[model samples]
Target chain A: MLIFEPHIHMFSRITDDYERLALAGVRGVLEPAFWLGQNRTSVGTFVDYFETLIGWERHRAQQFGIHHFCTMGLNPREANDDRVNKDVLAILPRYCEKDSCVGVGEIGLDDQTKTEEKFMAEQLELAKRHDLPVLVHTPHRDKKKGFERCIAIVKEQNFPMQKLLLDHGNEETIKITRDLGCWSGFSIYPNTKMDPARMVAIVLEYGVERFVINSAADWGVSDPMMVPRTVVKLEQAGVPRSKIEQLVWKNPIGFFAQSGRISEQMLQQPARANLRETFDGNSVLRGQDPDRV
Target chain B: MSRMHEQLATLLGPAAAGADAEFAKVLADRSHLPVVFPGLPRRLGRNHLGGGRTRVGDATIDLDAFRPCDLAAADLLIRCEASDDELFDLYQHGDIEERTMLLRALHVLPVGPITVRMFGEAQRTNMLVHVEAALCDGDLFARTVGQPGFEPDVANRVLLKLAFLDLPLARCLFAERHANPGLSTMLQDLATEREAAGRAVWRDTWRMIGLAPTAGSAARLVGGLEHGDDGVRAAAAEGLLALGRKDLFAFAEERLPREPRADIRAILQRCLA
Candidate 1:
């Protein structure tokens, strides 16, 4: 049962999460460029961060035999931060062409503000120019309205729904998005918003078509193993293994493949790893001998 | 609705009756083309559509994975009052099943350079479902084989892929109809490449080799009659039959008793029939 953790943030996570994910059958992961707890005061921070996602974090995950891909974008929270939003948007197009960057996302309403909306739309245009899919981070507050507003903005832009994946959804949002051509995403959490048990119920009811689940595991309190955990729950509940596989693997791969990069064949084998490899004179192994580590 | 649309609805029979309200509501407005397109499979049920062939674009396709309800719904999509550009955008934005529906419905859309290009772009996908949707159980390749806008010759590339996947080349509606010297050469090359790589060759390569026999490939076809693998021998004999060569008939007749497989023996019998 191969899994592609479609939306996990590994930059903030320790190396153990990568090993655990590999052991749990996560063959690949998509880390959407997102808020790093404390908002960065400058564009250079975002630049270094984006570089890390494609550079070191990717190298780190590959060491554990997990393919790491990331989306390049201005998070909706940062979208409201006028200090770096414009600069982040400027640099996104170039990073977007990076070999591992798959989409323009973790970009959508955060505060549900007009400013957030402005940058979200600009980044959406950036995605359009590059022709990459988007992973929209819908707000947790006033959650239902946030999903609605996100859909409204997408529909208003006349964005291609097939390339849009509105994430952080629940039972209510499924009804709203099921009819839309866009891919619907649910970020499974250890508790609160959505958990494994709830996800199984949704699978039993809604069926897994154009659906994806993620951990959205970031700097905050979240479980990185939500995708794998949800898989176990789905199986226990007797959802067909094929359907569960689709939610975890195929749906996300199919969605992101629209980028005209990455494909099922491309990920069939994990990326080769050489532990001694370094990025900009830095290695994740911290002075340990390459072969010994 | 077009005559074909009416035909699909009639085929659905009772299922169409249950789905009419949803269909009627969505079909009333073509503005819902993108959004309404994805919901078709769910709203119209994905029950395996068992039956004869259905035509799409300029070619006929077996409804291998397409549901009757989905096709009836897909036909509605083809009838959407959108322009070709709008339809093409939908194609670009569609998910796997949606794209498959759009590809299968290609005939009804406006045919021109862009239509030819849409078919070409789809072949680039590495997903077999997308590949199968574009090529298998269909004659979609025949119309675009040498069109002006289509470039890099995806048609032959797709045929090579069909061989690589070991999907029956016979399933391709017009492989023999469009078998040119170039395709024959590429296939023979593929056979060589696979043999050198110690991989199993697509047995159906013999069919095309027989259809457009070059001296080298035709010799290989004659050799196929004595090959160990039953399927390969069967395909080789099938390919030989296409040459209408009498010299090949005696060779097949001599090998008839040694052929143990019923299918290969059947091909051998066809030679002397």
Candidate 2:
């Protein structure tokens, strides 16, 4: 079945990872804009990083037959920085309007600071203005409180639950968001977070309705192949193939398609792998013969 | 209507004329330029309005380097006689596309000291597209070429940055025409630095400096012709062709018979043509 990786940081992965993803039947990948494992000193870096997501990163993904899309926002971690927080929020409107930007994202509570809450509420409004969905990055440290605070900000902003994707979810958070009318996202990892075996258990219990899975792989020891691995475990767990396909593909699109940019019809097409085509005269070919490749 | 108004009206047809009027009403408030700028591309359609030229300070920069909606956004700012302060503020805070258009449209606006800071804003970006917008077509660097007053020599910095980013030198349409001895020296130094660092130098480094070849770059043009790489040979021939450096092209012409690559042969044939 074709899989849509809903949250992997392809920017942090190598080109071989993209090849691996394609060989593993992953069709499309959504790379949400997030911090690069550390705080950026300025908004200039944020703008540059955002441009990479929409520009070169997208070009790089297409070369490997992956349909790349991204959500643009200030992440939860950087929301507390006095230097870049408001400036990032200041520049996010235009980024939200970019064609490949499917949502405002990675923009929920991390440390659960009042400043984080401020920017989360602000970006929730930013998404509403752009008519885009959101991918909220709940805290890795205090994830339970992070999920609650993220949900509270979304609720207090009166943001539609249908458009909220509370990502980095575990079994405990699923219990919170499953009946809350929002999409719940699980990141299947190699060792930590939710492993494939654990994700299979979640799928068995949650039944894949309004549910999504991703690698959430980034500048860390994470697996880009976790989604495909989870599909295997789900298969062995007696989860039907059609339901697995729905979980891997349809559910993510159903949530993000609220942007009117992405659709089932969009990802249904083959990846745009015209190797000779250059973005500003730099193709991924780098001098390799396209035909031979 | 101004030339931009006429061009946009002609290109966009009735839809563009209506947009101009709609924008004119918003321009009455003036501050609405930033508020309405980002959404124009979606509202106006992104069909490139085609290449046109405008005097940005001392240089005529390509307007088609900008998107149609961005051109319209720039035109709106121009229509309101947007002061340098306003343009600076918009450019200071504009996102990727916004800043790119602002940089590319720098030629259409009146040149001043404020533009220098705006130039710094483009330089500050780690994104190549932003730098491309400024130097390649913004004519911001072209304005600083021999004219002086701009600091740090952005013309050379942008060309080297283009190499660092692996974007083509062709993006900067006037790179060869704007070629200067300082830029040639800078390009040669960069080539040496890359070689020492065990990195491949930019293919077009010699090409950009071919017009104003320093001793090192001039020698590279000769060496590049006999280089084992077909792409290098083709690039060397093309560089000589641009410079009308027939003496250098003679080497490629001699090696043409032995050249197996059809692409390189085509360029070599053009060298003596």
Candidate 2 deviation (Cα RMSD) = 7.4
Best TM-score goes to which candidate? 2
Per-residue error at B238 for model 1, in Å?
A: 0.7
lDDT of 1 by residue, A77-127 (tens): 878887898888766765776557789988999899999988888888888
- Give the CAPRI rating of model 2: incorrect
Backbone steric clashes in candidate 2, count: 1
Residues B1-273, candidate 1: write the lDDT tens digits: 576556656666666764565556567755545545645554566677766576654557676655654565555654555566776775654544566666755644445575576666655555455566666666766666677765435567767778866778767677677776777888889889989999898888888878877657768888999998888888888888887788768889889888888887887788788
Candidate 1 lDDT at A33 equals 91
Worst 10 residues of 1 chain B by lDDT: B30-39
Chain B TM-score per candidate, please: 0.85, 0.79
Clashing residue pairs, candidate 2? B56-B107
Q: Stretches of candidate 2 above 4 Å error?
A: A274-293, B2-7, B17-38, B47-273
For residues B1-273, what per-residue lDDT tens digits would candidate 2 score against the true structure?
A: 377656545545545765677487666765566656656666766666555765433456565765666556656776777778778876655555666667766655555665666666655565566777676754555555544446446656655677676666776666566666777788778878988987777787767766777667767777878877666666676766666766676687787898888887887788778
